[model samples]
Target: MRSMCCFSALLLLIMAPVVCQGGNILVFPMEGSHWVNMDVLLQALHSRGHSLTVVRSNKSWYIKEKSSYYNTITVSVEKAVDQKFIQKVIYEIMEYERGASRLVYLFHLIVGMFGTFLESHELLGGFVSALLDDAELTTYMKDSKFDLLLTDPCWGGGAIVAKYLNLPLVYNARWLIAGDAHLAIAPSPLSYIPVTGTRYTDRMTFVQRVNNMILHVITQIQLSWVIKDVYQKVCEKYLGPDCDYYQLMIDADIWLMRTDFVFDYPRPTMPNVIYMGGFQCKPAKPLPQHLEDFVQSSGDHGFIIMSLGTFVSELPADLANEIAATFAKLPQKVIWRYKGEKPDTLGNNTLLVDWMPQNDLLGHLKIKLFVAHGGTNGIQEAIYHGVPVVGIPLFFDQYDNILRLADRGGAKILSLSTMDKDDNFLKAIQEVLTEPSYRNNMQRLSRLHRDQQLTPMDNALFWMEFVMRHKGAAHLKAQGNRMPWYSYHSVDVALFLVGALILLLFTVFFLLRCLCAAVCKCKAKRD
Candidate 1:
């Protein structure tokens, strides 16, 4: 009866009429070329006549233009943050920290990132200050009163801005599932929804569940005590002495996660989380004339596209040489996206370019396999195109992303640390290329992904617009958000059942003892 009542109420809320009007949106892209999903969303919103002003670093990749259609606010972040230093911190921990366990690496990752945050914009004066320090920009924002904030919370700048300006902040994620989502909004079962640090599947072993749960609890503590303190200090310095930091996040509008039920495991989700995994992908464009000729020349053999995305533009020269030699013996033509010095033993069967249209090449009919670092965007694109992959994961979520695809039988994962043995790369390449099953598996995955009733982009836009129209969609916020941990895990219920059982056993034992004593006394009297 209660469930039916709740369902009816929710239906009324959904059916409630809202004014379908446009909004003034402010977008802050994460500091990189990796904002592919967010970029797609922004373009779609722009096309629908919402006024958008995007803030990004000068070093970032954006469509260069000046137009009333949308605006760009450039801030110089090169002096504020070092990309190479950040990358090195994560890489060294993942690669050379052999003495440390995965959990220890996660701890160190948090510590390293925390220190990095303290040194960077989450301070009194840095890149963030640059954004607000601009008198013209701040004045314009104050006047404009942006109705919504589209931001990547991983960057930390967005959350600060949303609180400072009192705007509705919608968090954007590239490929991470963090604990903050569980504590802040959803009911995340740690046994199924693995932490960002671990690569456990939906069905986790007992030990894996224990570790994931520990990570989940510890992450919230770190956020509450460590990260939140720094953010509060920053807010106090700029916003006001009485500024509310964490509440801004806990009460934020929505979470635009780049996840789909097709790619990810079945798990509970919040009303605010909108999953649109393949938003970045589009219908494949016709190949360039030169590339068309190159692919055509492969004849019976096909080609492969190899890229580790923008963050990993270079590799060790020795590793590059080995990769080139491995591809040389294969019948497939390889388009290797290498920005470093060319390997001396590079072969004629390979075409080396600094940049390749990865999605387009994957869509090509003759493209056999993807040689990737297992970035989420690359994985999604490969799934979209029905191409099997040879994954060379480097750091962070790359290994995890590959794990998911490999689990689905469409990709084979190779460890970058053990790439010294030539057979590791060669065997993986040969297996994925020769096995028809890999191809068939990927095609099945593609069908599942492409079979959505509403297109991923349309689904994303609808939820976002719905939120905007409904004045932040508080009606959609889950009522269970504030339930205590014990209730969430059913710990209280278990305790109650145990207590009741103990009481019943004690009562039965006492009654038996009384009866035995009474019977003994009566027998004694009769004797």
Candidate 2:
């Protein structure tokens, strides 16, 4: 009995470190595709023995209230930023794209999106307010003693929650309330680092740089007057009148950025920011029997797979028919993820399903090309698997995402306005398929992406665990997040130097004049 007791004590001693490493993490994630990314992180955390609690809306479209990986705290709200709302907004954007001229489309796009953004924020703000107002929920949260809060800051609620709880904050982020995550945390010069909407590369033409500057100013205005205004009210009411919403945003302990150099242009990044672009991707799993048979039937030709992402389930009927007809003509078989009514023109070679295993299909050796809507996740996955893309950019950052790949010689982009006109979609796909350069360039990128010291997921996990172990990564956090705009940009320093230089010049001029007068007086005296 004493020998068994000694053995048990030894076992406990051996396992103590593993048991102590587990952390209690609180997550406030964004909905739709952002949640997909966050879910991947949550799964990794769960596998590492971390306890997770996800705060989700009652009307959440994708986030389930119950999951094996994490417990959920569901907040009730009058409305949610659900799929239906997004679908309606997307439909409106598509209509504008198809029906209007370029000038009119641009005007309507800006104005319409401006209102939509404000409305979305207002809804998210309301949800946050509801979560905070619930005395029981807030009390429970305080008592839970969560080590840190992980969130996607695309919406402002998570940042507000982290501040309210005084939790060590970490972000699984690419977009913030205003725009791209880099603009919020990094030194993004308008000269090279293109703003979110502009589809310009790092090497911009003179005119493009001028346009970038104009857009940068517009973005600043939108952030200050529009986006920041929504969250400022929330912060003032909940935290205090002294709280700055913008600071709360930039003050995260770590940022797991969903981009890498392979997919994104080189730009300034903060120390706490870790690029985990394709962390969610993995080697291809064996396809379902039916899918494998389909792939095998393609044989030497291989196959093409197209998915426009979660929000765009179906295109307009005419556009769908046009795409279907084009796919029918291709010799290679096509697997399309579409939920719209069957296009009368859809060929026997084309198979339409409601969903497809996107990453798995991308990694498959038999897959030849990807027809995508140019989402960040899709593009990164394409790069990860060495699959070339024929891009159809719909809205938001889709154009910019595709432009990066096109500039890198791995993609062909077709604008929505011209996708159906003169067989543009078909031609783009054919070009990507027939051209050897597209595959070769993308394969090279895949090698570069894979040639990393540590896997992106492993790197992300290390940083997350590091933050938990250290209470917060305060050492890694930059003080720039705490500085005022004038201080951060060094505007005051520049002005001070300019003023001092002017004063010195004036002093020298006055002294020279006095010297000349003295010399003339001496000459007169001598005469």
TM-score (all chains, Cα) for each model: 0.82, 0.96
Residue by residue across 27-46, what tens digits does model 1's lDDT show? 87664455666766787888
Q: What tens digits encode model 2's per-residue C-alpha lDDT throughout 5-78? A: 99999999999878767899999999898888889999999998899999999999899998999999999999
Scored by Cα lDDT, where does model 2 land? 0.90
* Whole-model lDDT per candidate: 0.75, 0.90
> Model 1: what TM-score?
0.82
> In candidate 2, which residue pairs get closer than 3 Å at backbone N, Cα or C atoms, i.e. clash?
none
Worst 10 residues of 2 by lDDT: 220-229
Candidate 1 overall lDDT versus native = 0.75
Work out how many backbone clashes candidate 1 has.
0
**Could you tell me the TM-score of candidate 2?**
0.96
User: What local lDDT does model 1 show for residue 452?
Assistant: 86
What lDDT score goes with residue 147 in model 2?
A: 94
